[model samples]
Target: MSDRALIPLLSAIALTAIIAACLVGSTTMSPGRLLAAMVGAGGAGDAIVLWEIRLPRAIAAFVVGAALGLCGAALQGLLRNPLAEPGVLGVSACASLGATLALFYGAAALSPIAVPVAAISGALAATALLAFAAIHTSSVITLILIGFGLSSFAGALMALLLNLAPNPFTLSDLISWTLGSVANRSFDDILLAAPFMIVGLVFIVLSRRALSALSLGEEAAHGLGVDLPRARGFVILGTGLVTGAAVSIAGAIGFIGIMAPHLVRPLVGYDPARTLAPSAILGGVILVLADIGVRLIPSPAELRLGVVAALIGAPAFVWIAIGRGRTHG
Candidate 1:
């Protein structure tokens, strides 16, 4: 790798290692026992804590983060807008509302698949709306405006549902999920999301060449034999799948979709293909660190991971807007 790429690659690995250490340290298992448990040589409780609890949560974090990263990258590529993200598309909001509605109607408790299925359906619905809007107006600003309107509608619907729900606990649970916390996510959550994540990643990984080709401009990409419709379709489907699955588990953890790709794009010399893996790794690390920070600073109450991300993301967003203003001026 070039020096530029080497640094991010090393940084990604280091962040991963630090996150692994933090996870082990934070849990009941000691460093030595956690190491032993990894090799299947620990006591039953240590093994259970390491394997059953921490391992799944860590894996879930990675998968969820990776999904967000890849989905964001794909959306940006498809939209030809650096600011495009799963969140901006209103897919995350739609999924959040879907999960909330499920909880409100007691469907989530009725079946294990209800939440994921509903969330995915909601994301697809948002994607469909975007597509319909795109047909009418191809402008990026218009697309974003429509997405914002959809998100607002979804958020309002969610609040209404929560208010009308008979059970207060259900409303609270739904609200907490909307705030986005990874605490107590089980192996079942991992299982439910894994297939979607994998399939989504595979599609996105294959689309890297298409993304890079499109960077030359859609007309040029078409002239060079790139199939525009197929490429855009893949991006939309892959992003929807990954983001939907992530929302199903983590409940609309926003900003990582925007942050991860932006953070790594410079290191890759703006190459979307190279940025992909680094973004995924960094996304996982950032969220894990954010989660760790949430636990440490907030103490026993535990901070919401989405809140932490937004705290970081909102400032970065302001900086971006200011930078754009300076450039335009």
Candidate 2:
């Protein structure tokens, strides 16, 4: 489909997904009741359930997914690699490490703001290191290897924190955060992360033209008047802000970034520039649906959102890897 047509289709799908998500929680409500609750015409209990519980959770899921999707598309374009993702590149790991440290020391108890700040710090550190490496070497293979090393190191640190947990409750909280979820999130959490997400998204949008030029290779892009350094700066900063803020709020949800863009690329004629918005919308849809699915599945307890995403994403990752290997081979 053309960009114009594809955009409306994606928007409609996103709207449908959001509405479905709002309706399908542990305490299910009909569409009429949901609308009534939204507009303050429903009972007090229903209002609290819909407004305070489901609405915030659904919105958080969408925001987190949109951030990841946009970052993934931008990173794929910037790195010119299909496998590029926040998790694959260790950015999410680094942010998780930061959040883990805060939780480990009980900073979260002291202040809700501490975790996100620390996460952002870790993300910026990782992105800066990656930017430095990119300047010194242009090999995608090298970058991927470096990312793997960083992820491994961060994982080790997380393990250490877990081993030294002061109590079972702290340990459990740490585990849950690492696993990721949007349940029980409040509007305050959304308010905290929105500014960073907005800034990151704006940076990505501003660099769309440059990202398109980048698909043609560095030298060719330079010849086409693309300022490689500035473009890279925007992408790195944008990715750091979005990914870090997302990790802070939702823990380390993975694969939506990689999956969303890949799903939408063909619809947008494979144009990197056109892929960003669609990927974001689809990402929101995917996460909202996943959140709803977790609620509906029969279990002793609801599944972690991150775990569900990983279960679905890991197979997709392997399939993509195999296909790419075949294409290259």
Candidate 3:
């Protein structure tokens, strides 16, 4: 389908996903009951489930997916590499590390907010560092390498923290946060992350035209009046904020950001700017569906959302990589 047509379709699908998410869970509620609850005529229990639990979780899933997808689309466009994701910048790793620290130090035991706050702080710190580096060099390859190195370092640190974990409980908490999930995510989680996500999205959107120019090559983009360094700063900071806030609550969800854009790119003819919104919509839908899948699974213990994403995404990544190799060859 044409992008103009596909965009609306994606939006509608996203809406459907949100609706489905609200309705599908371990405990079933018929559509009639849900609708009655929505109109305030159902039992109080239905209202609590619909309004307090399902709706907030669905909305949170939608927004988190969209933000991460936006970052992935922007990054791929800027890097001119189809495989790039927010993780490429090490923001997710840093956020994970931050949460690990909170778990390690027992800060999370004191309050529910500690882990998310630390994760956001870690992500923003990485963004600032990357932004400063961007000022020194305008080479995209250098930036990617730097991000890779940072990610590796953060991963190592996280491993060290895990090794030194004081007890099994701390170890479990660390593992859980690193694995990622959207279950039990309340409205407060959405509210806490929304501001940062919005600002991050605005930054990416601001860089959209530059991203399009960049597809023509850096020199061409520069000649076309794109301030390459500032644009890089915008993407790094924007992606960092979005990814960081997401990791705070969801705990390092993966693949949705990458898969979302790739799924929508063809419909938009691979134009980076044109791909963003639809990609975001698809990302949200994909995550909500994934969350719903975890809920409906008959396993004694539910799978983490990130685990499901990796199972689905890693092979797809390789497939895309191999396909791109053949296409270029």
Best by lDDT: 2
Candidate 1 regions with alpha-carbon error over 4 angstroms: 1-29, 135-138
Top candidate on TM-score is 2
Write the residue-wise lDDT of candidate 3 on 1-329 in tens digits. Answer: 88778988888898888888888886888889989999999999999999999998888888878877887788788777777776667777888899789878879889877877788778878777766765577665577688788789988898788788888887877788778788788898888777778888888889988988988988899999999888888877777777877887788777777888898888888899998889888888888888888788878788988888778877877787788889976
Winner of 2 and 3 under TM-score: 2
Q: Scored by CA lDDT, what does every candidate get? A: 0.76, 0.87, 0.82
lDDT accuracy of residue 239 in candidate 1? 75
Model 1 gets an lDDT of 0.76
Q: What is the full ranking by lDDT, best candidate first?
A: 2, 3, 1
- lDDT digits (tens) for residues 115-143 of candidate 2: 88888778878887887887788887798
**TM-scores of the models, in the given order?**
0.90, 0.96, 0.90
Question: Would you list the clashing residue pairs of candidate 2?
Answer: none
Residue 252 lDDT (model 2) = 85
Which of 2 and 3 is the better model by lDDT?
Answer: 2
Writing each residue's lDDT as its tens digit, candidate 1 over 1-329 gives 56466656756674565446335535545677777877889788777776667666666666677678777777777666677777777889998888788877879889988988888778878876786666567687898888889888998998888778778787779778778877777888989877877787787887888888878877898998888778777776777777889988888887787888888888788877777777777777777766666666736667787778778876775676567568766
What is the Cα root-mean-square deviation between model 2 and the actual structure?
1.4
